[model samples]
Target: MTLKHQPAYIIKMRAKPGQGDRLFELATVGMEKSGASDRFVIAREDEDPDVLWNVEVFRSEEAKDAYENSPLADELRDEIIGLLAEPPMRIPVHPYSALPAAPS
Candidate 1:
């Protein structure tokens, strides 16, 4: 059985002026295709439109590492460098209360 303590991460980033929407678009597409995040969510800051946050849940540490080593990751790294105001801050997390989705 998969324990609740799968490797997870949260990334907080700030976009350049007028690029928040574009960044959001890219994140929506990129995370979906990355094959890294089992659960991914994007949220925008209410007070600061340029601020964007991502919550990612990987199935395992290996899955997360696979994503880190992917060509797409390198590509996105290059792509995002131009879009951000500064380097993104990534925080590693250990979850104790992330509930699974309910049956439909």
Candidate 2:
């Protein structure tokens, strides 16, 4: 279950003025529906209410590319773009380590 060499990214997005919540909601829904990654997390920026970050680790680059280029993603992308103040930014990274989730 290691994401050691997986295609991972930290995507930064800023919502238009007061749309952060809506943006987060929609993005969460998209991620859940796509099931394109091994792990994905959405978090709000503590110092900036309008900013949100999406951290995702896909099983492989092909899976990542396929999901990103799919029609479902395209539609969600357009809607997401409309809620953004500006273009989203992505920072790629390599996961060298990971810990399994604890039991509920």
Best by TM-score: 2
lDDT of 1 by residue, 14-89 (tens): 9999999988888888888988777877999999998989988888898889988999888887888789999999
TM-score of each: 0.89, 0.92
Error of 1 at 13 (Å): 0.4
Instruction: Using lDDT, give the best candidate's number.
Output: 2
Native-referenced Cα lDDT, model 2? 0.89
In the range 1-104, model 2's lDDT, one tens digit per residue, is: 45887989899999999899889988899888887888988999899988989999988888889999999899999999999999999999978887888899
Candidate lDDT scores, in order, read 0.85, 0.89
For candidate 2, the per-residue lDDT at 66 reads: 91
Q: How accurate is candidate 1 locally (lDDT)?
A: 0.85
Q: Where does candidate 1 stray beyond 4 Å? A: 1-3, 102-104
Clash pairs, model 1 backbone: none
